[model samples]
Target: MPADLIFHHYANSPFSEKIRLIFGYKQLAWKSVIVPNILPKPDVLALTGGYRKTPVLQIGADVYCDTALICDVLEHLRPEPTLYPPHLKGVCRIFAQWADNTLFWAAMGYNFQPKGAAQVFAHAPPDAAKLFAEDRKSMMAQLVRLRPGDATSAYRSYLRRIANMVDEHDYLFGAQPCVADFAACHSIWFTQTQVPVMADILNATPSVGEWLQRMMSLGHGTMAQFDSAGAIAAAKAAEPQPPGANYLVDSAFQDDHGIPLGARVAVGGESFGPEPTEGTLIAATRTHYTLLREDDRTGAVHVHFPRLGYTLRKVEAG
Candidate 1:
């Protein structure tokens, strides 16, 4: 039997919500492991090394970082209600990438205005806002963020484009939801659900709002709470699953960075949450790079990251 799906994420994470909705769409039961919203993410770092991002998916001894890779894993596991439609796979993937990054940033920029930020931290501890800001600021060091006024304008324009897409079909591409739908929904979902005060921005695009309601109705599938310690123990006890011969047979070593397989390397995001994860390069496919790393708590594991929007480097010898 396949090992249980273990997800590490928090409630307010928009990316996590994307996976959760995918679970609902697939009707898959999963183990939910909630981690701290802000650092220090000791438990998460235990598995990801330094990739302190929310919503890391753990299957047996394999750890998948980045929602893009997680979505691929989920689709591979259950191909019934496909995330990538056969005919529109390329288009769906391109649209999803844009939604995950471009749309997400614009939505967040608009959502976290002074008014929305106050509403978000209203019920939290006094220092919650400050700590959250500092944590995000550290992750976003050297990256440019859109200002509220500019974000509002861009977000509105994006919404109108989305409105045009969904004006005819029920989803962005067609009658059924695809990877692009889930990716786009999460960002807008945050504004509508987490920051209702500023949600009026979505009101202008009635079509987008209606589409969001449909996506929201899917709800998160069956979920059971799983603690960090238990998750770590599970990983420690299981052996890493070997990739199928077919899995890597056709996937030749596409060396873009000149880093050979078995070399020590560090992979990380190009912009936000730039903590580098160091490990031995195991697989370098056209789309992603996989690393084999060991942790005292989790033993041997394979951490996967998408090639795009991320940087790869050789870890210098000490």
Candidate 2:
């Protein structure tokens, strides 16, 4: 059976945008489950067992967290129109990593300034902004964040660096749009599309603006909405395919926490919105890990965790 895809995400999420674009790029049918932008996502938490980031990919009993892993899963599902070209594979990986880590944070910091924040909360209640601010503050561990001034300065520098890349070719790395280009462009898209009041920063780089149009033209493909309950039902109704017989190079299991297989454990990012989920570590491949966790609201589910920026510790000895 062609794997059923459940994208657990919200519309305004930039990382979610990246996956949406990929879905369109591959012309794959996906079920959209609009997760809350903030916390207390009971449905999602139940499925994840703790890792609560946006844009998780669910296929039957397998759940894939992190856009990077989702990208790979999508690639494996549909190889044509490859995101990572054979010749540019190394550069593509490097660029995608940089885009996800650096460009994404910088653009978000710039986009969430006082004006942008006010615009975002314009339709919201008085306490809405306060609650959001408090929630984000708690996530940051009460660290004083970069002021609007610092954010603008940093964002402008990052934009200029991207423009330098475009000065050579239409795309960041080369002629074709690689993983890096799409990953980097989504954050900028969020700035320009979601928070246009502060989008003048893009005017400094005409090339990037042109590139943004190209990326947007790719357009999000055939997306049909489905509720959380429906998604869980779909998952429970299906079974995940075993990862095909492919041997991983230098594949050796690292037993760090003495958490044996089938032990109840949760894996997720360390800091900033640390929502961990409980699951069983059934498969730990070189590229990814699989968690078998069931959600009462949704039924038995399989959640996938990327081995990067995630911690795997036992869920007590119970």
Candidate 3:
């Protein structure tokens, strides 16, 4: 039987939209657990410990963080309509990483300008904007954000580059949509769907606008609502199914941090949402790391994070 795929995410999360689009592309049904858009995500923290980022993929007793790793999990689950087409595998990965990090940051910096934030919080409570600002400030403590004017200039240039990429093919890299296409689409999607006033930035690139329509048409696949309590209970009752021997393994133990398996460690993002999750290091592969952790509410679980864009360190005991 197929494993139960539970997605913990909020509707407005751009990364969540990327995964949702992937789900649509794969025609996979999944359980949706909507999380809060702000801090004090207690329920979410109970599962992730300290990795408080939105859009975490929970499978039985295994929790996968980061869209890159989650994409690999989804691909492993349903191999057809592969996200990483064999021919463009490495190129697609590199492009997707750029889109997810650099392009996404530029688009977001532009989208959250004073004018766009005003539009976003227009319907919300007066303090909603302040709260969001404080929350994001804390999450991105030391990370440098581009100025609105600079971000706007960069965003436009990036959109033009994307237009060039999709000018000939229906999607980036080929006729069929790949990881790069999905990674690039979410940032644009956020601007169009959530902040239409700012979406004028996309107008200059007509090809990109047309491609966005094609990407949007994929639609989210069948989904069922799931409550946090139910998800917690499911995790409590399930045993983690970490990658088996058949799974990809690094030839050498590739130890750069001097951390070893079975040691207590913490893994987290280097910039935004830098909260670290501490656990017993279980598996450290070439592409990702796995942590074996247990909670009273969720029982034993294995949390996974991609090696890229994350920091791993030994937890110093008091």
Candidate 4:
């Protein structure tokens, strides 16, 4: 039997919601391991080395970081209800990428305006907002955010564009909810779910609001609660799947980077999340980079990352 899909994410994470909605769309069974929204994510680091993104997907000993790769993995596992439709695969992925980054940041910029931020943390401890701000400040590797005014304008314009797309159909792409729908929805979902005070901005696009309801009706699929200790145990009990056809791009080494296989390297986000995962570079496929990570708790593990929006570097021995 194939290993279970063990997902590590928090309830309030916007990216995690994107993956969760994908699970609902695919109706796939998965195990949920909620990680800390802030820091001290020792369990997460054990699985990802240093990739500190929320919503890490683990299957047996293989740890997949980034929701982009997670979406591809899920689509590979469940191909019937596809995220990448054959007729519009490239366009779907491109739009999804834009939604994940540009739209998400814009939504956050507007969502965190004073009143909205206050409303979001109204129920949490007083330090919650300050700690969160500090944590995110550290995680952000570069200053790519827009000013509040620019963010509002961009978010409004993007909402109208989405409204135009959904005006004709139930989803962003077509009759079905493709990746673009989930990608676009999560940003707006954050605004609606986390900061309703700022969500008034969404009132202008009633079509988008209607589309969100249709998307939410799908619901997250069957999930069993799995704790961090249990996840660590699962990792320790399994062996990393050997490199095979599924791990290869064209069944050969695609050496765009001068560094070859077997060298120690670090793979990390190019524009964000400065933390890098250091390990023996096992595979550098056109689409991803795989590293063999040895943990005392998890033993030999394969950590995979997408090539886009990330960088690969040689890790020098000290």
User: Residue-wise lDDT of candidate 1 within 213-244, one digit each (tens)?
Assistant: 99988889899999999889988898776553
Candidate 4: residue 81 Cα off by (Å): 0.5
Residue-wise C-alpha lDDT for candidate 2, range 1-318, written one tens digit per residue: 256677899888899999888887778888888988777877777667776778788776667788888888788778877899999998898889888876777787889888988887788778888887766776667334566677678789988998999889888878877788888988899889888898899998998899888788777767888888877777677665454421112234556667677777777665555566677776665566667766666566667666766677777765
TM-score list, all predictions:
0.97, 0.90, 0.96, 0.97
Regarding TM-score, does 2 or 3 come out ahead? 3
Once superposed on the true structure, which residue ranges of model 3 sit more than 4 Å away at CA? Answer: 245-253
Candidate 3 C-alpha lDDT tens digits along 4-97: 7899998889999999999999999999999988989887888888898889998878888999989988887888899999999999999999
Cα lDDT of model 4 by residue, 1-318, tens digit: 268899999998999999999999899999999999888899999998999989899998999999998998888788869999999999999999999899998988888989988998899998999999999898785758888999999999999999999999989888998998999999999999888878899999999999999999989998999999999999899988766634333335789879989999998888768789999998887788889999988898899898898889998889
Quality of model 3 by C-alpha lDDT: 0.89
Q: Model 3 reaches what TM-score against the true structure?
A: 0.96
How many steric overlaps does candidate 1 have? 0
Local distance difference test scores for all models: 0.89, 0.76, 0.89, 0.89
Off by over 4 Å in 2: 142-145, 243-259
